[model samples]
Target: MSLAAQDAAKIPEEIEWTWEVRPAHADAKLPNVLLLGDSITRNYFPEVTQDLTGVANVYLMASSTCVGDPRIEHQIAEFATMEGVRFQVVHFNNGMHGWGYSEAQYKAAFPAFMRTVRALTLESSTLIWASTTPVRIDKEVGPTNARVDERNKIALALITSAKISLDDQHALMMEHRDLYKDDIHFNDAGSKIQGDQAAAQIRAALSMNRLPKAQAR
Candidate 1:
């Protein structure tokens, strides 16, 4: 079996889950955008959809699955094909979960993450890599920003080398620790801040410096 399969077989996480959202009655006239990340992404998703209202149909594929598990790649494929929509922009991230996997294992599996996302994008599809947010609580059992930072460094090197734009959410959140509603997730207000920034980035990517909002589908 492949290394990722081995890790999955030995998976240590107490629970595994995935959440997906595609705009209902999507506007074919507008371009599709996808936000792929974790629960943190989910928290900010509504605000992003609202911010980009009438501008784009925002879709979300947030999961507890981390980079080391091979399922992450398969799940991404499933989400893409299941929607059958060509995303104009995909803002993707991982590195918050799967603490059971070592950084070395993460590094080893990083290429699959890159390749999987790339395969799903079109020639015109814009890709943005968002750095994972910091872990605020000093938990003996969960994630640490130190590890998050290290993983960011690992991803940054590869992503920049691939010439993908970065959303830099890690740096953004570092300035707003006061917004943390929990150890890892942000409050609604804080999540709105993140969503606004994401909308702004996607706007810039779409070259919509000034665009009218359309009623959401």
Candidate 2:
């Protein structure tokens, strides 16, 4: 093979992306909430932080990789081990970026992913599972609605079986489809709506966390 061809072949087929946002002064007195997901979460993160300003200290652990990806475990572990931090609620979603994998593969990996996440958190922490947002039909950058629907069904099943709280971001986006800026992402208005919903869920989870064991029971 030619040198250029060999060099091209050396390139990896998969690339892993990760990022985090830790507040400089995360109030120890208030509840800590972790938001985990992909670009959609990144886009709306500011609004979520703002909306939850005094209510809770929100941290973001997001990446372009899917929950099924091994790297995600590392990311979760890193966040879980943050010094003197205990999350009161964790809101997580993953489905948009694993387009290369079939629905079955996605389904098969979900339980393990949830297990890893659960193992890393405090037992008392509320685990809220956010459904993947809607995808518009696009031949390029494709994640057709059909594919998203399939993955969401699998996620719903896993979440239901585990008895986690559902944030239902999918239904919210579907109701405001016109606010989408493209096939995958939302515009400013749409992001605020998503942020509001996320903040609301986080607040509810934190409030529940404060209840007496008997009342919560």
Candidate 3:
């Protein structure tokens, strides 16, 4: 009935993930945006919402499982229908989990998941696919850097073919390995930087999609 109750009902009992909705200011008239990913997204989400203040309503849907996980599609569908709001942009990533799944298996499931995401959002909504951030070799216990790279390559090919915008978070973090606190998570400063990048990309995508009709003519 309530938003929380609805979220609870949507989440699978066996799934392990965190779902948080950051409502826009009640009086603030702005576009809605959704950010989907794992803990890396959780780390930077606050900064993203803050950075986009007065610009858009930012929502976050994060999971501990891989993007290929079937349960994630259910969570995403719920997020899209929350309060009957349609997001203007959906920025998403998921490659940190699913270590048990081989690269080929990951590749096979990715397109289907993207299809679900596309179906749930507005036809005009900008779908941005963020590559998984790099993991520190010394600290990562599940996915190694080599594995991350392999998965990312597959993701890139699929995302490009789907005609989705690529955010390339992997490249953003590659040069700042020191900013990472562990294999996959970033420190506060790192998160801030990531949030800034994500905000900029979302803003750009929104602007591009909202171009003046007269200007086009």
Pick the lDDT winner: 1
Worst 10 residues of 1 by lDDT: 208-217
Winner on TM-score (2 vs 3): 2
Query: Tens digit of lDDT per residue, candidate 2, span 97-151?
Result: 8666567667767888898778756778999998999876644545878888899
By lDDT, is 1 or 3 better?
1
Which ranges in model 2 have alpha carbons more than 4 Å from their true place? 1-15, 82-84
Instruction: Write down the lDDT of every candidate, Cα atoms only.
Output: 0.86, 0.81, 0.79
- Top TM-score hit: 1
Clashes of each: 1, 0, 0
Tens digit per residue, CA lDDT, model 1, 1-217: 6765555553558988999998987898888899999999999999999998998999999999888887888899998889887778888899999988888788888888988888766766778899999988857867987899899999999898888889999999999999999899999988998999988999887764234445211
Q: For model 3, what is the alpha-carbon lDDT of residue 150?
A: 91
C-alpha lDDT (0 to 100) for residue 164 of candidate 1: 85
Candidate 3: misplaced stretches above 4 Å?
Answer: 1-15, 24-28, 138-141, 213-217
**Candidates ranked, most accurate by lDDT first:** 1, 2, 3
